[model samples]
Target chain A: MSETAKSSALRGAAKSARVHVMRSQLGRVRGLGAAHGGTHHWWAERLTGIALVPLSLWFIYAALHLSGEPRSYVVRWAGNPINAALLAALVLATFHHAQLGLQAVVDDYIHHKRTRLVVLLLIRGAAALLALIALFAVLKLAISG
Target chain B: MKDIRDALMVGRTSDGRLVHRPLSPHLQVYRPQITSVLSILHRATGIALSVGTLLLVWWLAAAATGDAAYAGVSAFMRSPIGVLLLLGWTASLWYHFCAGLRHLGWDAGFGLDLPQVHRSGRAVVIAAAVLTLLTWIVGLAVM
Candidate 1:
């Protein structure tokens, strides 16, 4: 084959490859499932991240104000309907976000298959239990106070 | 050193990359930048928050257990060191919260430009500091 023809053929092949890559990337961006679980996880993390901003700030304000207060005072404060409702929301969102973030860390670092699975489960369980306990305590205070 | 050796021996994968394996451009090779520090802080705060949740569990369990236990926990919380930890936790919470907001912004297709990235990072740091100070001031007043 002539050198000019050979170079032209190579150029054509490169162009086709570039086009293929562009199409695949567009498909992945559209979330046709080629990207697997990443898009969902990313979306969830962002949603939770947005939620936690105000909820966390409110929690900090609530906690700081309670500093140096007596137990009864805290209980009474928490018993207020608005505070109780916000506290529940804060705990739930915090725990959910925590679990998702920690899961990413665990999946990133933990190497042993069994250990990774166990650690992931443990993280999920711990977050869930903490949320439950916090919610229950808030409810108890709200009711009993 | 031992952990590094063990990791190499095990030949583990982290984030789809080989861990502790012979690779070009290790973390040490790159100079530390603000973004790098912020990224590390994000993970550090995450781990701290995980541990801090246990403290929450303790407080709730104490409340569930009854008045005396609750009082004991409350008393401890009022102590100097406890107060310091509480303050630290509060700061961590604020910093993490602000950084998380930055991450959300990035995820939502904002702040990807270099100038915006740096600006957002600075914003996160400033917001966290201001919020922490404001909360502390209010706390002192309430107390």
Candidate 2:
């Protein structure tokens, strides 16, 4: 190649390399990238974690109260509008947080990429199924009452 | 003094890609500490709680199904085996809950010091125990 052409190509290569490095650095600073993405996952996990505090306490208390109660009593307790609303909130938050936590755990320990993806999907599916079941039960009681 | 290449063994896989099996430190290489043990327990209890959710779904389903189904489930739940399972689930729930709070504390820039970490680790266990016991006592009393 001609001297000018060779020099121009070298400069272009250097500029491209610099741009690549700059993009990676920017990614690191912005907390978003191919590897880590943004902090949304972290923030969502914490938000749900915090929500679980009150919901979990309420659930334990309610569950304990319902223990050994007759079918009619359970139907009545669950049919209460306030109780149904709280139970719905609890199920949604619990399943959402559980899905996020399980995804993190599986991603951390399961090394095989394909296996990790499958497990994460399975976790989400199971959480959704359970959530649906809980919600349906609450709705049944609420409507039938 | 020794050859460095001996420490860096790279083998070609069947797909013709080079791979290195790193000799990284694992659980056996270090002494057990409160923080590390608690970390493992945190994961364990999380899994336990996930399984417990299934039981919750079953109870809710039975309740929604009808009187006979609810009666069957309620009977099992009050049985010896069922009570034991419930107790374990209760303990796991509280442990996970306490550990989760500790994690939030770390995220909020508190309890990051080594001593504080250890203290909080201990606190999580104690709180879980106390809470579990209190819940069961009150639960049984009201029953």
Candidate 3:
């Protein structure tokens, strides 16, 4: 290869490598790829979603068993330790998953940044509050039963 | 609000001309597909399930309060409207459950091909119906 051409080629390769490094550094600085906190949210949704599978099925079975039964029967059912634990797990996971999914929908459809933020906060807050109430009910019955 | 609306209105040039913007394609622009229908249903069912959870809260609260309170809630549940709501809740629960399985499958890198996607979508509907029926039948029979 000609000396000038070889030197220029080496210089070009070095410059390109530097550019690649800088680009990655810039990406890191941007922090979590635009959405800021998507991975954990997504993972939590998926995990809770999966956990809901058997829990939901169990809930359905248990609920159906209580169908047409007396109030005392239903209350007694809830008081069972195993039943209460399962119910609590299902309620928590289902609400958490719902919140995550709703957050995703709001984020995608609500183009107005301020509105999106407000909606997300409202959803999260409501989900947490409802979940707490549900869990407390389950615990109260389970304990006193 | 008026100023915001004015700012949002497409664009205006100093020469007093307004620039036209191209309209984006929306739901009408695309042909309906199973995946799309199921996707929308997933969201709808999710919302329904959230509402249905209130019933759970009510039942628990009633039971905790007293026998009379529980009877009031239980009576309403035995009414025709209550039965219908229960049926709806059951369907919503199973539908969401099955569709959720489909989602989990996709997340795990399975049934993502076009044909498989359609098959799973159909499966979700069928499974939900069958499940709802089975639960109700067994429930009523034993009751």
Best by the DockQ measure: 2
DockQ per candidate, 2 decimals: 0.43, 0.55, 0.45
Model 1 alpha-carbon miss at residue A51, Å? 1.8
Candidate 3: fnat, from 0 to 1?
0.53
Worst 10 residues of 2 chain A by lDDT: A30-39
Q: Least accurate stretch of 10 residues (summed lDDT) in model 2 chain B?
A: B1-10
Taken over the whole model, the C-alpha lDDT of each candidate is 0.79, 0.86, 0.83
lDDT of 3 by residue, A12-97 (tens): 99999887764465566765643456779889989998898899878878877887677778778887889989988988998898
CA shift of B128, model 1, Å = 2.0
Model 1 docking tier (incorrect/acceptable/medium/high): acceptable
Give the lowest summed-lDDT range of ten residues in model 3 chain A.
A26-35
Clashing pairs in 2: none
What is each model's TM-score for chain A?
Answer: 0.74, 0.75, 0.77
Give the residue spans of candidate 2 off by over 4 A: A1-38, B1-23
Report the C-alpha lDDT of model 1 over B30-131, residue by residue, as the tens digit: 998878889999988887887887777678666656789888888877789878877888778888988887887776779889888888888888998998
Of the candidates shown, which would achieve the greatest lDDT relative to the real structure?
Answer: 2
Backbone clashes (count) for model 1: 0
Distance from true position, residue B2, model 2, in Å? 9.9
